[model samples]
Target: MSGTALLLVLAAAVCHASWNVVAHGVSRIGTPFLWWGAVASAVLWLPVVPFTGGLGGSVGGLALGAGVSAVLHVVYMVVLQRGYAAGSLSTVYATARGTGPAVSAVLAVLLLGERLSALAAIGIAVVVAGVVATGLVDRRPRQAPAPVDGAAAIADGAAAPASTGGASEEPAPRADAAPRRRRRLDPGIAWGLLTGLAIASYTIWDAHALRTWELSPVSFMVGVTAVEVLFYTATLGRRRRELLDVVRAHWPRVLAFGVLSPMSYILVLVAIQTTPVALVAPARETSVVMVAVFGALVLREGSVAKRLTASVVVLGGIALLAL
Candidate 1:
């Protein structure tokens, strides 16, 4: 990564971690929160789009890039929510994040014609390892319930967002309902893989959009947020009341997520303009360590030694990338 690219991705990481920290209980609220967040993002950032670069390309190109990215991002949320509902949280979260950067790195090299140095490649691998280790920290002997999908979560009173891309803290399924939602044969690995692919797909495609189409990051993201708001609204069905309740009760968090989530991704898009996606992909995983720090310091969670070890490993990997 170029030094500028590195700084941007790290800033993106901090933004990503900050919102995830702020959105602690969003999973319990489900689609309503994401809906509000999307609405807020579009409305909040629309004005800045013109100042940043306006379409920065043809309207057709901007629509294509933003439209496609919106679909992929929504798919990511749906699949990730299902993964939460399909298996253990730790299983889904760890597997998806672990798989995402690896797949993104490989595709960046093979499809995007980006090359990574041997040491940088190793750095990417180490970062993925540390991220998975951090994700794995939530596992318990009794097993937490799988998370609920957005639509289902509306009915069940739970919902989760994507990480890197957004969050996965949907409340565990009700104890009595957990068994039926979980698959005895598959666990969460299947859904996790699907989620991982979705993550990589959007990551690569969004990079392609910014790099190939030359769309302004702000405009593209604003378009994406607008499309997502529509998609979420169409799927809301009879849940309009839920949306209103969330808006009224949690507008602050909705606002925080709206601003930070897109900020995180917009920064990543900018980084990808100057840096190879292979490096930016794994480098973004640094957010996982920041989240661990949040858990230790803010949330007063346990696993201090383990989180510290993971942080050290992730930092070491980052050092390798800088080499």
Candidate 2:
């Protein structure tokens, strides 16, 4: 691969992970965030449509493709937000990234009758195992609670209980002071799998639409992002106050997602013109590792070593699939 193309792919991976981090940070606002994202992305990218390739010679197909893609992407965004709310960043991002290509490969085989070599089959298995590993990484056994401060408790005059009808004067415990529970019940993995399914749906339809209509990457992205705005507006028209509040509170994250999300895709598309897709595709999965590491280190939500180890395994499978 050319050095420039490789660099572009790596850059795209960073953008992808960066935007995902942005998404997780503000996902609590839900539809408000999605609405702002659609609007900002469309406005940000609209100007580039003409320069990249206007319509790719098919206005009708562009509408159809963008409409369908909009639906798919909205589903993706909704599910992704829910996943972020439900689980740690590491588990959700790692599992979704790993699962997307696995779902795509399965679809290609089942619908297009594409055959996988032995290596590809093994890659699928490895990906599945790695996804599970990431998902379960946060479900670690709870550490034993710290020993209570007997000296401080005694010095604080626990004898006050005698004044309260002999009721124990133990402090009303802070809400989060309890030992961890329900680690096995975290729904992050399930939500991640759902998000991955949404990713595959959009990826398949978008690929077919772009190739069939010969749409330029820029035009197609602009069209789809525009459609997304319309969809978000139609669905969220009554949420003006909520939307405005999110923008007021988190405009930095909103704009970051707006820029980073599309930039990631556009960079890969541009790189694909010069690099073999086999290389570009696997390079994109590098974000799987970056985000996992981000979650473990920056977010401090899971075991760093466990998430990093699982992310590496996922990337290994991706490399094999690329082969």
Candidate 3:
């Protein structure tokens, strides 16, 4: 990638992570925040849509791609919500986001006939390893206080008359509070996998669509945003009110996320158009590293040391890919 393209990718990575953090903070209303994001994004792309000429030869293909993208986005949103609910954002987001570009790279090879250099292959491996390590480390059991015996509880209650002893009466922690045994259908892992697949599908399909159609970027973006709005609105129905509530409650944040997300995507498209897909995809994956850092430092949600280490590993992978 040229220096300009690389810089644009980096900027997009930052935007990607920031918007994800914003999304994580949204009130849990299935599909509501998504609709809000779509609407906001559409508004942003509206002005540019007018500049795009009427649909031509590849318009159908692009529209079909947009429809596919909308479905994938819904799936991605579902998984993202489940993942955030079930696991630490640091771990789930990093793993999901990091694995996407690697999957995209493979799909690009199979479907788009894109090739990866040796360095890029190594970089992808490193990213995958880092994602695995991050997830495993998060799965480690957290310490819980031992259950208190009845006699001990009585004695502690009796001793509570004395200020010193009562001060020592630490509440017995419930065993149930311990991390639940990993189910066969671990929601976090499932969601992470789905997220990866959704993103991979989006990237691959979008790439093909772009190649097939000569539509201006703004026009393509508006079309996709419109499709997304219709899909989410139909799927969310009565629940749409709940989504509206979230928007009303957090309009500023939602709007910011909406702006950043589409802008980041636009930047990525620009970069991909200018550079090799191999280069742009891996570079964009660096958002995983940024998200890990943001989760640890900004969100303050996980073990700082583990998050930092995982982030470094992810960055190392990106570096290798860039080489």
TM-score of each: 0.87, 0.71, 0.75
Encode model 1's per-residue lDDT on 119-232: one tens digit a residue.
Answer: 999999999888888877755532445345464221101123332222347786798887875645555678878888888999899889888878899998899989988998
The residue pairs found clashing in candidate 1 are: 84-147, 162-166, 162-167
Q: Would you list the C-alpha lDDT of every candidate in the order shown?
A: 0.78, 0.64, 0.63
- Which scores higher on TM-score, 2 or 3? 3
Two-way TM-score contest, 1 vs 2, winner: 1
Backbone clash pairs for candidate 3 read none
Each model's total of backbone clashes: 3, 0, 0
lDDT of 3: 0.63
Q: Tens digits of per-residue lDDT for model 3 on 1-323?
A: 47788788889888876776666634333356667777888887777555555442477776876777666665665565555555444345546766677788888888888777887788778877776665455554322222221111000001100001112356755787545553235554566676677777777777777766754555666677788788777777567567657877889876885688787787887777656665677677666566656656776756778877977887788677656
Ranking of all predicted structures according to lDDT, beginning with the best and ending with the worst: 1, 2, 3
The candidate that wins on TM-score is 1
Error of 2 at 57 (Å): 3.4
lDDT of 3 at 175: 81
* True-structure RMSD, every candidate: 6.3, 12.1, 11.3
Ranking by TM-score: 1, 3, 2
